[model samples]
Target: MAEARSFLQRNRIHRALSRSNLLLGGDRELVLLTALAAAILIFVVLTVYSALLGISIWIGILGALRWMAKADPLMRQVYTRHINYRHHYAPTSSPWRRP
Candidate 1:
């Protein structure tokens, strides 16, 4: 006789398993670094001007990052791979391209 499966027996994958894995609407490392930088500028700099600057920078950049993340969640990975590419690729026919 087959037994009915209970809800507790079912496997539940986390959000990380299915999603593009965003953190604070951008790359995890980038968001954390931005927070640290803003905190330092706002508090460690020890001036009202610096605090204002930090707040503005944080807001502006975070907004941009959110837009970017929405546009392409894998942008950071794509960019890093692109950085090693040569400036020019051979414009040869398929016949010439073969080793």
Candidate 2:
């Protein structure tokens, strides 16, 4: 009789690695960058109008990012990889053939 095996079952680490890492309902790095930029603008400018503008910009960016994330969590990575490929690639029959 063949022995049963659960050895290939997914574990906690696998789940963690597979999940999308989101921040403020959006991509982590992009949200952080937007926060940093907004903070800099708000503080460095030191004006009521500038502060309002900064907050507005930050809110707009966050809203847009959140909307995008809701649409697709892995869109950023997908788009980055997508841009590297051509619209169509011809098949190569042999290793020696020039691509």
The alpha-carbon RMSD values of the candidates against the true structure, listed in the order shown, are: 5.4, 5.5
Clashing residue pair totals per candidate (backbone < 3 A): 0, 0
Over the stretch 1-99, how does candidate 2's per-residue lDDT look in tens digits?
A: 999977886646677678799998999988999999999999999999989999999999999999999999999888987777756555678768986
Cα deviation at 30, candidate 2, in Å, is 0.6
What TM-score does each of the candidates earn? 0.69, 0.68
What's model 1's overall lDDT? Answer: 0.82
Residues 6-47, candidate 1, lDDT per residue (tens digit)?
A: 666668899868888677788777777898899988888889
Which sections of candidate 2 miss by over 4 Å?
A: 1-17, 86-99
Task: State the C-alpha lDDT per candidate.
Answer: 0.82, 0.89
Model 1 residue runs over 4 Å out of place are 1-14, 87-99
